[model samples]
Target: MRLVRGALRAWRDSFDCGGRSVAMWFPGHMAKGLRQMKGKLQKVDCLVEVHDARIPFSGRNPVFQEALGVRPHLLLLNKMDLADLKEKSRILEQLKQEGLKNVIFTDCEREENIKEVVPLITELVSSNQRYQRAENVEYCIMVIGVPNVGKSSLINALRRLHLKKGKASQVGGEPGITKAVLTKIQVSERPVMYLIDTPGVLSPRIGSVETGLKLALCGTIRDYLVGEDVMADYLLYNLNKHQLFKYVERYGLDAPCDDIESVLKRVALKLGKTRKVKVLTGTGDVNVIAPDYNAAGYEFVRTFRKGELGKVMLD
Candidate 1:
């Protein structure tokens, strides 16, 4: 009942604010979601799948393909500013091999990039419609991606183009900010165009069901949780598989003969460990006086961002 009321209120508010009639279909299950929108899917004609340029594979919602089955989709890779340039080109090539021709690299924050989007979308929509403007034909395009990839910001920018009301919320954070179901924004003087902004989806790793669900919801193991010593252990274990040891040298961390415990002890010394070995190991309820745990954590993540841990995709 609450969801229904919220949807109605949103619809009414959007309608009053120069928006054409719009309805949102909340399809929680991928299969059911696709089926519910099948009728509207025929009218959609064109679809736009937005993904974070950093982790394109990770940012994608698998259900998008199911919903947009057999329909034309424009893959907009946004947030290039935060991504590794080398990976972008590699992923783009991979997607091309998958038979996706309509892919555009964009940083939607820029005016030039925003300008390019509408035209590209317009052209795609026109092509899908065979250059014919059918009566009462409503053009619909859905924007989907992982959390904190700037979908709201993109919608807000698009709203600026149309000069509409009902502002899209400005989400500020590292990632995973937007939580609403779907937001429908409309253009004033068009064929009643509709833009659907769905909730951001976190990607799941290939693992046990519980682990996958946790990754998909909270995210894939935040570095801050395990502290630097433990984080370094995980990174070393993973990167050593590919013979990447520059990470330790980069952070000035001692690479003590590939012994995880030995390296942890070295890290503790660098961090000004005041606690005794018994305390550190919790042998006698001794307080582990690691004063620089936070600093160590930052350094570890910094090294990772610098690619010292090799080409690791934390999806």
Candidate 2:
């Protein structure tokens, strides 16, 4: 309640570029009074839907489609840094199939990557709103995304990249950063578009075991939802039949088979000596076991990310 109010006040006090309207969009789980904010999106001329490149489907806002109801949207795939290049390509194709024509993959931390989307965003807004000299378009552009997926980072990068600093005030998130803000950036390229950056959202579906791990890796879910051993077990199970099982074989483990549990136990045993103890250590000295479970867990993630398990998308 308080965060939302504070954000609304900040936007109201900010200077207006034209007859434009902007507002922050956030997850339903983040705060109270959001239920009343529903149907408010109907007023926006264009929607800027932000999603993670890694798990696009899981990172999407469940209420977005319902709220917008045929409104035009520009889907921004943020955080290209952590995404698998192959998976990122596939996800973009999938989104096009899902009816999003305006899409841009960006790592807003770098200005070069950020500028590539300027022409695309400009074209989308111009086409959707169609501002003419005779009459003003009076635009409203809303930015929506899952929490901690770099929504604020994108907005901040936008201001800095465009050299419109000292003009916008963005709120900071609790236990995170940047709770909410809706600001206008004077884009000489895209004069008709009024930008609205909303608070990040963490949909409830992301609480699932696999999706949660993905979000945790993305820094969206901060708490230790899964321990090192549990995560390693998950990776082992998921990657048992993975396409790049050859990598495991390269490490001298047996070729992975259909039975995932067997593969994990084998991995545990194989790394036992590295951890300075036996997999089933009792009386044996602790200096001769495989890699510790925690270390093994990191290796699993590292290998998985490096395509050791093959082309996999945790969608």
Candidate 2 C-alpha lDDT tens digits along 1-315: 346322332112221223322122233445432332344554566667777666676646666676554666777777666565676667777778988766777776665377755556555656654443233454566667666666666666776766566435353322135454444444333344456666655554443455655554444555344455545555554444234455457546645444434555565566662445444467654444343445555566556554455554456
CA lDDT of each prediction against the hidden true structure: 0.53, 0.55
Report the Cα RMSD per candidate.
16.2, 15.6
**lDDT by residue for model 1 (117-144), tens:** 6667777777764548667667677666
TM-score of each: 0.58, 0.60
* Model 1 misplaced regions, further than 4 Å: 1-43, 87-89, 110-112, 129-132, 135-138, 161-167, 170-176, 187-193, 202-288, 291-315
- Model 1 accuracy (lDDT, Cα): 0.53
Q: What's the CA RMSD of model 1 in angstroms? A: 16.2
How many clashing residue pairs appear in each of the predictions shown? 0, 25
